[model samples]
Target: MSKVVLITGASSGIGKSIAHYLIEKGYIVYGTSRNPREKVVNGINFVALDVTKTETIQQAVKEIAEKEGKIDFLINNAGMGITGPIEETPDDEIKRIFDTNYFGVIKVIKAVLPIMRKNNGGFIINITSIAGYMGLPFRGIYSATKGALELTTEAFRMELKDFNIKMTNIAPGDFATNIAAGRYHSPIIKNSPYEKKYKSTLDLMDKHVDKGKDPLIMAEKVYAVMQEKNPTIHYKVGEFIQKFSIALKHILPDKVYEKMLMKHYKL
Candidate 1:
């Protein structure tokens, strides 16, 4: 029988691509989006959802579980990016980021756990980022969310192993997606003590996103991991930089790496 997959943040970028890829492989994909632009792209099904909304998360799970009988895979692919220095980032904005990127997935995972545990097995693909493995200068808060995800992934992998539930993290290094979709909404950091530092960082972040790898490629890797019988806890998807950055994370000293990050961001 084909696996039943539910993906959050399915409106665009990597989430949208994963939905398409999985559906093509004959998996029943329930794609979630808050303001979904276009629904029903060939092999996919769309469910309107806001990841930050408890009511939406609960409702989406019920709809899928009732219809599909069980959920074989859950991709917590919905996330947002927040840049600028911590001092410049307002408390409200930081809370907002954590609500969407961190707590949002937590809600989805909690809602889906019983279904997967009842079935005794399934896979969870959490779409983290290169920022997950190593910190970036301007993306202070965005990196925090990814780091939280990476740690949570490890905890889930260990905690859920006996139940046959797999938690795999997809850490993509600069995949081309709508990661910067609503950057203009980012609040001004004028009150921030580190305004200058954050401005430079935001500038670099905006400049580079257009040149990243296609998100469809990242989606394909996500597909491969979902199909694995015994998947590793983490896969660094896209480009050699993933492998290199992870390696540097191990081989290089802390200060050395920080220096490199500064140089790379031209900070």
Candidate 2:
């Protein structure tokens, strides 16, 4: 039987690309959205799931399991973006993003674990961000959420080992996607201390996404990782500079790295 793959947030962007790619490769793909207009799209079996809602997450997983009899792979790709100066960002907004990007992922994993364990084994791949490796100026909240998820996956991998389940994190750099349109932007407050610099940084971030790599690159990378028998704990997919920044942080002095980032963001 072809492997069954479940991908959340598949209505658009990177998740959609991954769903299409895997379907072409002969995987039985179930792609989800909070609300899907159609039950299936271009070979992807669409399911309704809201990452922030535990009920929706459980229902989606149960629906897929009943139909397929087993879920061989789960790509936790459901996440939202937030961009703003940390001090200015609303407390409610911060909590909302964490609920979607961090806690939501944990809920989905919890819902899927039983089927994977009963089926003998499975793979869970988390879609994180390269930004997660380090905090960026205006994008701090988004970075923190992904960072938390990244760390959680490290611990999660070990705990799942005894059950023969494999888990890993794949952090991708900016990809050309509709993420910018969907992300929450803490309004650019007039005359606030961070106004000018925050505006500039936000513009630069949009440019990076506009020129970022094709989502298919991430799709291909996901496919490659799935073929691995002994997958590593973390994998990054992005431009050399983005991936290199993570390495630079590890080796550079704290102030030096901070300076480099400040210089890059023109803060």
Candidate 3:
């Protein structure tokens, strides 16, 4: 029997790539996008559902359950990127980021847990970023949301281990995705009294994000995780250099890592 998988934010980038690969792997994929009018990608089915809407969540679940009978995997991949100095970033932008990145995943997980538990087990892959591991200058807000997701993923993995729920977080280095397009956000300095405190650092981050890895590789990581019987709590993907940097960051003193980030980013 083929495993049934549903991926949110499935219209493009990593989610879309994973959908293509999984269908090739024989999983029955039901890909969701905020809009229903996506061009048909051979091998996967697309559905309309916005992660931000609870009714949309219920509707997708009801429809999928009717057709597939059970869902074996749920990829909470619907998220956006917002890069700007915390001080100058708009209050509204901060809320939008969290709503999509953090709460959106939570809503989907809550809806799927019961169905997964009934079947004895299922996998939950949360697409996080390396920023989840370290704080980059202007990426502070984005990092914070992913950091929160990292901890949440861990808790789910441990708490649901006995229930056979497998939760995993995939943290990729800067990827060549349109997430940068979504980076049009106000700097935290907008409302801050200390706007001058971090202007240069914020600008530094915006520039570095331009130099990210190809997003196609990120899709491969998602497909590989699907083949694992028991994936790790956190999997790092991307170029060898970024992987090395993460390893170095893990082993070094906080100040050393901070200095490297500052210098490399020209913060």
- Which one wins on TM-score? 2
Q: What TM-score, to 2 decimals, does candidate 3 have?
A: 0.89
The prediction achieving the highest lDDT against the true structure is 2
Model 1 weakest 10-residue run by lDDT:
182-191
Using lDDT as the measure, name the better of candidate 2 and candidate 3: 2
What clash pairs does model 2 have?
none
103-129: candidate 1 lDDT, tens digit per residue: 998999999999999999888889888
Q: What would the per-residue lDDT of candidate 3 be over residues 44-109, giving only the tens digit for each residue?
A: 777777878888998888889888889999998888887666766788889888988998899999
lDDT (Cα, tens digit) per residue for candidate 2, span 1-267: 999999999989999999999999999999989889999899999999998999999999999999889999999999999999899999999999999999999999999999999999999999999999998998989999999999999999989999999999999999999999999999999999989999999999999999989999999999999999999999999999999999999999999999999999888
Worst 10 residues of 2 by lDDT: 131-140
Candidates 1 and 2 compared: the better one by lDDT is 2
Q: Cα-based RMSD of the predictions, in order?
A: 2.0, 0.6, 2.7
> Looking at candidate 3, what is the lDDT of residue 135?
83
lDDT of each: 0.82, 0.95, 0.82
Ranking by TM-score: 2, 1, 3
